[model samples]
Target: MDLDAFVSAHYGEWEHLRALSSRRTLSGAGADELLDLYQRAATHLSLLRSAAPDPAVLQYLSTVLAKARTASLRRRTLSWSRVADFVVRDLPAVLYRTRWWWIGTALVNVVVAVLLGTWVARNPSVQTSFISPAAAQQLVNHDFSNYYSQYGGADFATHVWTNNVWVAALCIAFGVLGFPIAYVLWNNVVNVGVQGGIMVAYGHGSEFFGLILPHGILELTAVFVAAGSGLRLFWSWVEPGARTRADAMAHEGRSMVVVVLGLIGVLLVSGAIEAFVTPSGLPTFARVGIGVLAELAFLAYVFVLGRRAVREGFTGDVVAEDRSATRPTAA
Candidate 1:
């Protein structure tokens, strides 16, 4: 392995790789040539490392190869156009298809929350158990309402978004394990119900609704969606139907990822309402109305756009091209 001779023979190939990598644009032929040159250069580098290696020569080849790899990956990266396509076509379709899973979760949670709140409000003992009489009175009198206005609007919005997103993410991440999803939903529902009961018991029921509903409706819906998606993922493995267990889980996992990303955006809207609108000087009707409108808009997106997408044969799964090839096996 004569290092000088080796460099002399492969230097041109390395230079070609470097030139192509440095180019701002490449034609089809030029791109093919660049790839070919890159492969050859990589081989040369490997040979240099394994055979008679010179520090300077090896350094040069390595640098050129690195640049070529970067350029190749940049060309393959997703463009803004692909992002738009996913948002318009893929995301809503999956949400629509999985609506049943999360919708039921939402209804059950709502019922439990209302019942718990009523029970707690009607029982002084339960209310006292949740919080001291003094603290409960304080929350009912001031703290509950004060929370909305304590921070600046923008800061509050960011804090609320982050916290809600964390909860939503936990629901999805733990939903697969079955019990965790139930636990998370139970904790959230009880917390809401308990707070409502405390407020109502103290004679600020209107204030509680006014403060909570503006953000709670959408925020809780997002959490329920995550929980539902998680439960569906668990079911995919439990009752895999005709597909292999692995295949069913893979499909549901990918679709749930889409739901998680979409919920980030949804939680952002709810956070903004909680921070800015809920605490604003608007009347209770108008504030609650805005929240209702936002909730309805999300439902429309899931049902209208999602249903249409499903009817067009979208299942919220990745395109066949992107999924693993199915291997043939003995029946």
Candidate 2:
């Protein structure tokens, strides 16, 4: 290969590519042109490396390729509008669609906790079996309340956020298996029941309810949402309805991802409450009122925004172009 001749032939194209990459905005046609030009320059680089091996030319070509790569990535990166659409439409739609699953899970958890808590509180033997009477008194008198205020507000909020997020994530991640969701919820039920039972047994039931309700309302709701998402994913494969099993599972799985993102925000609010509001010197009514308001805000956001999105033919899955292709075997 004549290195000089080859350079002369592609030099104009290289300059054009550089110009395109430097542009402030790229239209579809310009983007297409830039991509084609980039590919051609890459080929030219390969030829030069193999035949001529000119270091200056290779270095120049490498710079152009890097710039082009950056430009391509810049074009594909998420814009504010895309983010707005996701927040306004995608998150809520999926949450709305999955509402029944989480709501049902929440109800069952609550019923179990209430019944078991009642049993534990009423029975002296059960309370003693769970914890020494002295320990139970300590928890009732100090430990339970102290747990919320042990750290500064910001540190406690972060700790609570990370822990709750992990629990919610596990519920979604293990949703397909089905059994883990049961285990997590059951574990949660037992903990709440035992704690409540012990507190009541020690004549401090009011304190337990007062401390928990502020954060627990939203915190447990988020957990239920996660558990529900997992159950929905499990059922997608089990029944699959009119869709093929793979297609159903894929569709529901994408929807579950939306729930995960939305729940992160939900848990953060709850964590904030648990850290600052629940433990703060505010009156009990004021603290619980803040929690109730937070819970209502989340419910309204999901039902209003999510329901509207669902009504507009958005099922909380990725847009049509982004979805995996269904096989001909799909029912």
Candidate 3:
């Protein structure tokens, strides 16, 4: 248990180990020397623990050995494979699995918007409830179409993209609370319905559809998807099925975050359509047809690629190695 004598004997070896560890590159001899010193230091640490425990020497040996061990092990290099795997497999799989949740939300929102719009268009009192007759006329006559063409195409696209992304982000971020998502969906529904009704009432219904449908189909679908993901996330916490509540939330939350990233791209396309195509001189049929095609393409991506991915066991969460280790809890 002579700590000073032991330190004196091994100080040279310890110093060598530290030097080797600090080096950025190692020659064959240097690598061999590092391995030998690392092993000796480990043994020395064991002896220090058992026979002559000096805190300073033990601490120094531990740090040097830890560094040496790390250096000896090969490190993994980053690659694009992870990103490719996510886009090809994980993203689609999660979207497919959650298709019902969002599809239902889409249908319900559309129906509500349609009914409310029709009701408002049919009733003068309801039309006047929100908009004065003068304002309504102004909006119908000029503001409706002018809104799209007011800004340059690029600026309008960027503006719409940013705004829609913000809404989608909020849906995911606040989705843990169930009612917030419902409120968001309701607000969107009411806004669309009121606007549609006002436009139809003033006999600009054809023009309104011409402007909105091109971008609105995909844009609204993205919103619905986000709302669905958020609501399902809340439900995961409420009814975790076979998994623990924490597990369910972790799985669903990760998947939804990925959906948020994917939706950015989707919303970007929609914004482009709104900015460039909707306001362009394209015929109404052509414009609306383009939107429908884009919407169909997205649906196919989910139902085709997504279904296949789900079948292959992708779930849109982080790769297994990246997920945090968790203690198992009973469901």
Ranking by TM-score: 2, 1, 3
Candidate rank order under lDDT: 2, 3, 1
TM-score of each: 0.82, 0.88, 0.79
lDDT of 2 at 219: 97
Say which prediction, candidate 1 or candidate 2, comes out ahead on TM-score. Answer: 2
| Alpha carbon lDDT of each predicted model | 0.88, 0.91, 0.89
**Candidate 3: TM-score?**
0.79
Which of 2 and 3 is ahead in lDDT? Answer: 2
| Of 1 and 3, the candidate ranking higher by lDDT | 3
lDDT of 3 at 241: 80
Which candidate, 2 or 3, has the higher TM-score?
2
- By how many angstroms RMSD does model 1 differ from the true structure? 4.2
- Residue pairs with colliding backbones in model 3 are none
Q: Across residues 1-331, which tens digit of lDDT does each residue of candidate 3 receive?
A: 7788888899998888888887878999988988989899999999998997778877888998888887776344456997787778877888888889899999999999999999999999999998999999999998888999999999999999999999999888887988888888888999889989999988889999999999999999999898888888999999988778888899889889899999999999999999999999999999999999999999998999999998888888887876877667664
Clashing pairs in 2: 92-306
Per-residue lDDT over 111-140 for candidate 2, one digit per residue giving the tens place of the 0 to 100 score: 999999999989999888889978887888
| Candidate 1 TM-score versus the reference | 0.82
Best by TM-score: 2
Off by over 4 Å in 1: 1-35, 40-75, 327-331
lDDT for model 2 comes to 0.91
Residue-by-residue lDDT tens digits, candidate 1, 224-260: 8989899989999999777787888898998888888
